[model samples]
Target chain A: MAQQPSSDGTAGLRELGEFGLIDRITASVARTENGTVALGPGDDSAVVLAPDGRVVISTDVYVEGRHFRRDWSSAEDIGHRVAAAALADVSAMGAKPTALVVGLACPADTELSWLDGLTKGLADEAITAEAQIAGGDVSRADVVFISVTALGDLAGLPAVTRSGAAPGGVVAIAGTVGNAAAGLAILSRGFRSGKAYIDAHRRPQPPYAEGPRAAEAGALAMCDVSDGLLQDLGHIAAASGVLIDIDGSAFEIEPRMAEIASALGQDPRAWVYGGGDDHALVAAYPDRSHVPEGWRVIGSVWPVPDGGEPAVTIDGEHPEISGGWGHFAG
Target chain B: MAQQPSSDGTAGLRELGEFGLIDRITASVARTENGTVALGPGDDSAVVLAPDGRVVISTDVYVEGRHFRRDWSSAEDIGHRVAAAALADVSAMGAKPTALVVGLACPADTELSWLDGLTKGLADEAITAEAQIAGGDVSRADVVFISVTALGDLAGLPAVTRSGAAPGGVVAIAGTVGNAAAGLAILSRGFRSGKAYIDAHRRPQPPYAEGPRAAEAGALAMCDVSDGLLQDLGHIAAASGVLIDIDGSAFEIEPRMAEIASALGQDPRAWVYGGGDDHALVAAYPDRSHVPEGWRVIGSVWPVPDGGEPAVTIDGEHPEISGGWGHFAG
Candidate 1:
């Protein structure tokens, strides 16, 4: 296998060639979507089926310096991160991912092999989600931009929305929360270099199938931990006319999470409450037992008594982890 | 309705906010599809149907200062242009557009109102195609980047491929060609000053419905004139193992084309033969009468003699225009 070249190389995009790079990237991917994909990649457009009569879609873009820094992450890792972000949206909708289309933009200085590695990472994640890499576009730009659109099938379940949670429902999480946040802090603190923190930033292993499972299990409301657990849950609280209470004691920091907390000399609570990009699924189920994936029960939903603003309280107190991931705030 | 403010406005993307901008942009856009859209925008993902049990998709990206200049094109125009480019790919495959997902990256200095206007343009184009603007992602970057993916339904037609044309087939076109090229020249040479040239640069109106018409009319090979007539037709010829011959008399250039040529003292053939972004449908049909609405006969497809290279020729000779647009040539 030809290894991806480093960006430090002076060869521009034209030197690498467009069609040649595309062929290299697409060579590793395989099409397997139960005949719903009439046409896969390499055509003007690809065709897939809405076999269940409905299709679900979401799109996301990741820029080179803003979303991912080449100094901090590998091309493969960036591809995985981008794919995870888009797929997490699909999962949050209580849908099954079926396909993904990606658009790539890079400076002329980009190498063909780097793109090939990115494609591999993207395809691997798609396969893990039981989806196919349907199609994509490529062009030249000053920096790299990765745009992904993930399509999904609802499978006959009424989408469990952020606005659907009723008072008295149980608040739970189906995957790691704050892992990516902790990872971010670890990277920023320059404390330690470990594969765990690297993977958290590079490729978040979101519980892909848990979304449909949660919907089937009667999740009243749900969202992924893209914007921190409490911040995201607050969106549900506002939408569903309820208050979500987080049991602070219920939080159990995983080894990686604990490691980051110790190194940074910070409480894991901050990361747990305010960290983003873990892509963990947070949902409210009518009955705690109905929560699939053995998700830990964290708290319960409460009605905002007599017209008060919706909020999220951690053990009767508001935990502080300021605004989550402001785009332009210095 | 408030008019979109320029990027220098007080309420910018980083100020008026992410969710707030999204709400403004998504307002008033139609979400209904052919009952094939399972889930519409506003969630993690939207779902649609690919009735032929397959899905066709394509993506393209445009960046500020590369594909378009912010000083020249309005945000709304940029949105429209992006959609047109992607939609042309679906039309090239003889498919009906179903949905569009856009990814936008803008600087913090970008006005929130401008983003809204850009969304309006995208939604308007989506409505024009009777497709839904499903979902998208926004990120903060130094330069504005727009990525679009167009999903289409093939409806059981064996994709009329560029490689499928046969010898002795009539070549025809549906919709205007060379106008966009002429407009480009006018803009480049500082010829035309107002709406006509600007409109050509901002929004391209391809014969959207004629794609399926050509497919139904038994077009053996087809593609949209995105990369100029002869160059695009050259793709068909090279793919189909046939020689494509064009007659100059068959072409009907707009009056502005000659004006543009005269101003630059360059042949109008450059615009007709090498120009792109026209989005006109070009196809080879066995019978001329099978040509669909707005289409005119222009050339014929002939078998390559004794295994010579499948090529494009004009009036029994190979004529040259400025080479087609190359992404990284600059």
Candidate 2:
């Protein structure tokens, strides 16, 4: 919706207008000279060369209050987190991310500087993943909302779907698990912590290269830990018609997570098992010895017993913990 | 922004919850067996086969109350309109749309049936365009917002960019113009005409097949008229260093638009020149004889006057009407 002109004489989005903002944002975006991008932004559509003849595509949406609060995280943090989450999905499919198309909506009063920072963050993450910012659309909304569609190159490898895990496979994980969840808890409690856990919540660095490495190492199935380790692994278990059992003793909790949990009078294990948004890659391998170097073997896959449901278990028992992040449930 | 549980027990989104609502919405989406989509929804990311080794990508965002008011349009209408708008961009690039990935954000109190209708609308549009609904993401927001990314195949043709127009080219248009604007005007007056014009505003059917045909016929430059004729053409004119001059007499204004304009005591020419969202394909042909069958030759391109501004003119003179839609300007 259109808003009244700012009477305070501040330069707002309404003053800069849509085309002006687009020009500014596009000009600021760093364009990498990648051969995969046949045609970049400034056109109606971008043409990307899918060298392997196939493209891996995924989309994710982030709402201002629901996914992140402007009061809690900077615009750059939000942009980086959103880009990482979307790219991680492509990585989970064992694809090399190529480009990203962003769709953003914000209130008319938003500052141009905020958009500049957001674009820089998007470019920064895209560069880190060796992907380019292809193109994007901007619109007006009540609050800031971002939607990212990531495109990836599979490099001629078969996609690692959730249904590929076998009963004899060993489950492994790369990257941290519960630091983001702990950071979120600390922030929700109105406490400011300068620990790495707080930054993990603000910006998650997914194990990008580890996905394809696992795929090359003969990984049977893989997924990113966006909805907690147990919940995400449960999806693989259900799809593969197998049981996934995690050994609690195999997990070595980070000292930062332990300290934060102790300060909050909570168990760090819950955060490791039930926390979401870490964007860690968890994969299934037929043999533990064949697991990639960076991955830690934390569990094993088993056949579903007779008519019993394919489930996830901790230390040979069902844990009394609730499922990970559900937007409506929360 | 989670909403309180509906005390009236009307089966709101909160009651259905995120996963349940996702299942319901996803199940309703129609799946067409297209070879381009190697893998569809239900995975972390979809795998699409880019047989031509290149893919065309574009994205658009639609915010409720800003882009479309619920009181003015049904959920199905909103879905169809958003899909068409995104696909039209790919079409403008002389590509055949192959797939769409939707990202939706809504409040927790949304109705389940509404989402079903929305999903149906998306599927209907995708099927009509011969594209598959590859995958999507859903999240909670304070209000309804949709982001659609469209992927397309070029069928081995070189992409037609806006900067390719030459001085001797003829400007042509496919599909109608100004009907949507007239419809909006009539609706704003609280009058329900139930005419084609009103329906055009609610759901625009872009000329998808004409894009590739125009390219085959040797169109030099092309674009979709989403931001009105003059404004969109201005982009081409500026990019190509050419001036486009329209022959006002060549435009055959539909009787419906004329009637609506007469009722509101407004000139229909203004709507024809300044209307947006019609998604009409405007192109520059080397000659008028080369224009496709469904296209009407409305104007001709000329070399920019020495040191003068690149512009659009009507009947060899500059018009006095305001330009088309701007998100912030509105």
Candidate 3:
């Protein structure tokens, strides 16, 4: 057995090794507010109580230099972002996140402190969502890769799915839109200003509680705005066999956003329509009257025309810009 | 949206894109035997029934080159190995694995056929475990990284943790040991004739059913032999506050293993004692008289001496060999 070092020196993961690091990290796991964690972070597996007799599970991966850059985001930021994104998936399905299991792969020489920060970020986010860090696995890799699997309790509500949209439904969003994409653009172009956008990109605060609210309000379909507004709406359209027509003017361009777009000489509408990683819950309702509070109608769904593709149109017209963050499409 | 090509020519992931590839792979997922999968895939999240109102969860990460080599293992082999390893963890807790959510990070230029083979392997292994492919997330990365999160149901049984071993308990193993390590050595030494050993290194078949049986028979403590016989037992010993003494002669090393070790000019005992990735289940029982069928008693547990560390000994003596597959250790 290896002993933990008494001093808090700058020892890398290689010095501590796998089990040693695991012990260090496991010791630091904060007691969570979630009472559903029957067992946490030990033994062969963790036991979690699923009060509803059902569990909603969603997983997402974040790779260094692809999903995020170490130079642009701190370890804490990465952890928070990953946790939020995973939890948002559960929320998109109209469930309350109960626990998360993280799988982290990083270089052998990674700083122990970096991992501590990352774990702190995960714990903090889990706490905000009223969930617990159930269990995780760590390994050695060339670049940092974090895979988060979030488990949620549906609380006896039917899961809102992308395939449930009806022809007369209205599409709405429960969280901010396009801010993360704008932040990414600002960071990529070497812009130092735009604190709000930059923060949105680094730490997205997905509306976690609004998901079940929307489902309870009779949301016909739901998804997270992870792959931009239009592209994700396209998913609902295709899945539900409906044509979604967006009222572009419904997305009010704030003065700050307009000013930033002017400085960058870019279109704010492009960001609003094509930006991603916002983790906003987008859902469709039978009518605007039934749309839950904090959710604003942005579009309307219609039956797909015969021999026509299920599509998303801006102001009833096809937009010139298309697609958003396809991992394999360069 | 990119359309799937009619012909299976030389199209890579880059050509087909993320959504297209996902559609291709998802279409191949087979129906699972476990009835817990309420909703499988193609949704914002997967819904699985926790019939016992409790879920056992575990996760593991497999990185290319660090955990396995493409030259040594096929996509199918990698998928099978990861799925088996993850399911084994759930089994170690005396639970029936219900579902798995996979997170894959690979290069954009990766061949489509490779991913197809990988998905096929995952589906095949899920079937073997009677679990379903619940859902997954795919992203772009420099190298292939697969994270598997397994969810299981306890079926009204208490979870078997590593801290329950009594002083008078006997340590036993329900699956083969050292075969994976021997296979790895054979592969490293470039011995192509040891097909069994090499295959074992590529794919481990754990006795999933025996875990619940051991628990029902009142096994005290249990864990999967993922980090070698001695190292993993050390975990149980430390957790249970007991010392375990192994009878080395109890491990019946087959003639094939001896022949392979002879060819490689290595001690087979080292592999048996310190080999890993076999994923065999090791348990502590009250005595050999109550040991379940298919399980062989390898040692006995005793109370730790005062002011002494809980430890493992071979034949009443400390073994010279130490350590097993520490991911960050050289």
Local distance difference test, each candidate = 0.76, 0.86, 0.88
TM-score of 2: 0.96
lDDT of 3 at B253: 81
Which number leads on DockQ?
Answer: 3
The reply for model 3, stretches above 4 Å from the true place, is A5-9, B31-34
- Cα lDDT of model 2 by residue, A201-228, tens digit: 9889999999889888889999999888
Locate the minimum summed-lDDT window of 10 residues in model 1 chain A.
Answer: A1-10
Q: Which digits, one per residue and each the tens of the lDDT, describe model 3 over residues B90-196? A: 99999988999999999877877778778888888888888889889888998999999998988999999999998988999988888888988988877788888
What lDDT does model 1 reach? 0.76
TM-score of 3: 0.97
Kindly give the number of clashing pairs for every candidate. Answer: 18, 0, 0
Q: Rank the candidates by DockQ, best first.
A: 3, 2, 1
Kindly list the per-residue Cα lDDT of model 2 for residues B50-137, writing each as its tens digit: 8889999999999988888888878888888999998999999999999999999888778766776688888888888888888899
Candidate 2 deviates by what RMSD? Answer: 3.2
| Per-prediction TM-score to the true structure, in the order listed | 0.92, 0.96, 0.97
Error of 1 at B70 (Å): 1.6
Can you write out model 3's per-residue Cα lDDT over A1-330, one digit (the tens) per residue?
355843564578887878887777677665664687888887889998898899999999889988888899888898899999999999999999999998999998887778887888888888888888888999999999999999999889998999999998899998898898889889999998999999999999999999989989999899998888888899999999999999988998989989999999999888888887789999999998999889999989999989999999999898887748778887
